[model samples]
Target: MADETNNPDLEVNAASVSDGAYTLIIADFSDTDMAWEAYETLKSVEDGRSVEIEGVIVVRRTTEGRLEIQKATDHSTKSGLKWGVVGGIALGVIFPPSILGSAAVAGGAGAIVGKLRQRHHNHELEQKLENAITPGHSGLLALVSDPGEIKIRKALERAETIVESTLEQVEADDIKAAAKEVQGAHA
Candidate 1:
């Protein structure tokens, strides 16, 4: 007889996600500095009450044609840190520091890709993110759960940033592949 308790699929399905609804927002900036500024601005904005931000990552292509990924170390917004933790953990699974090379990595990042794999799946978001951030430019990718579009928009507007591409209901696999692809290019 099979040990049902040992079934990986069942275990994954049992894992609970604090929030199910999420939107992947990829905002491009004129420069890497602007992208980091926008990311900080978004983290500082008081829009969490209306929207739950699960995670945020910044991607930039250097003039030398290399890719860099950065995750938030400290977030100011409500649940920003919480979601940032989740995002960090997820990223740990997708892009370990060894593979990341010189790219910055956050604390508490672990191999939890198995957990994320159970919750989300889609590569299009990653592809879009890779395409949107070009050399000399930067992009901010965020995973927000059930946000009030208007409020988030207003917050971003206040930060003086604009969205390049927005994909709602993204999956973990998509994010993983994208990160992998970016890391792969450099490797």
Candidate 2:
């Protein structure tokens, strides 16, 4: 799941980003719903050109201690199709496959989803997420590229969400090895 929107004309007010990645952990949600609400709010802001959202995943620890991960989908396409009668450009054209592919593999295909998959395959980050968000709690893990910090902060604040931890200028390999020190754990 991805935003798929690559509007070059879309204005983004942010400082020049260095060549690297960043990880933001939004935690302390009262429930999964609240976390999703915050995610939706952030997505809406991303849609409106407030910030550059690269990838997002929602993690929820169920009452029975199961970890659930939710990825972002092309909601704009669904919404446009549902309201196609209103007469507007199809979202597909606005967000072409080529653009989405380029964005996904901007740094490298392995650097984006690969890291997330590594996190899932190993139990380190998953365990940390589970521990941070106990049963009945929820959190969000977002990989943003040169995000507009002010806009993102305002959007989260408007949604009444608080960020628990943030690691900037993060390396993809470092993220992939977050749980490497611990062995014999599987997702």
Candidate 3:
């Protein structure tokens, strides 16, 4: 679940990047409680596999479709034809077109490898993109890390559309000013 509280000062957030930790802007929930709830949901997903997401920060965007990201998380997994056949068989049951049925059968021999590979990247990238956007509100999801943040950040930059990035500093005043401008324009 994502926080969708509307804030007049949605863009009044800044990014702080250091050698150890990074700052991410995300949506501003109604209160600390809602933010904490969303954080818990994300934290609980660490079953040891997915790129260890340290935390999730929500910054509201005054603009409609802007996603500001810092460090991107790259998650790539590989599988062979066997998995594709198994998957295609399952899919064919749901989609019973003549071509699709034949494709599913042929996939058993390894034709589905390309399909699965494409799907794998698509799924991973799509998940990251979704994480960046809120359900209703428009904004960005900043993912910060220490040494390993580079790879993650690159993956995000490649996959996402609108990304604004800057070093974190005591620049909340500037951000607040920018937020005011955005709000005024939108209003």
The root-mean-square deviation over C-alpha atoms between each candidate and the true structure, in angstroms, is: 14.6, 15.4, 20.5
Q: List the residue pairs that clash in candidate 3.
A: 15-168, 16-168, 26-58, 26-59, 27-58, 27-59, 71-153, 72-152, 72-153, 73-152
How does model 1 fare in lDDT? 0.47
C-alpha lDDT (0 to 100) for residue 59 of candidate 3: 30
Clashing pairs in 1: 120-172, 121-171, 122-174
Spell out the clash pairs found in candidate 2.
none
Tell me the lDDT of model 3 at 73.
29
Ranking by TM-score: 1, 2, 3
lDDT winner between candidates 2 and 3: 2
lDDT of 2 by residue, 34-139 (tens): 6677677766776424465544545555676444444344232111211111001111111122222222221122333444443334333333333454565565
lDDT of 3 by residue, 1-187 (tens): 1112432233332222322332332333433344444444444443324444433333332244333222212221121112112222222221222223233322233233333333323333333333344433433343332313443333232121323223233222222233233334434
lDDT accuracy of residue 176 in candidate 1: 39
TM-score of 2: 0.44
lDDT of 1 by residue, 1-187 (tens): 2214332221110112323445555555666676677667667664666655656767665665444665556453452244344444444333323333253343423333434544443354334334444466665656666444554554443222333333334454344344444334434
- Name the weakest run of 10 consecutive residues (lDDT summed) in model 3: 75-84
Clashes of each: 3, 0, 10
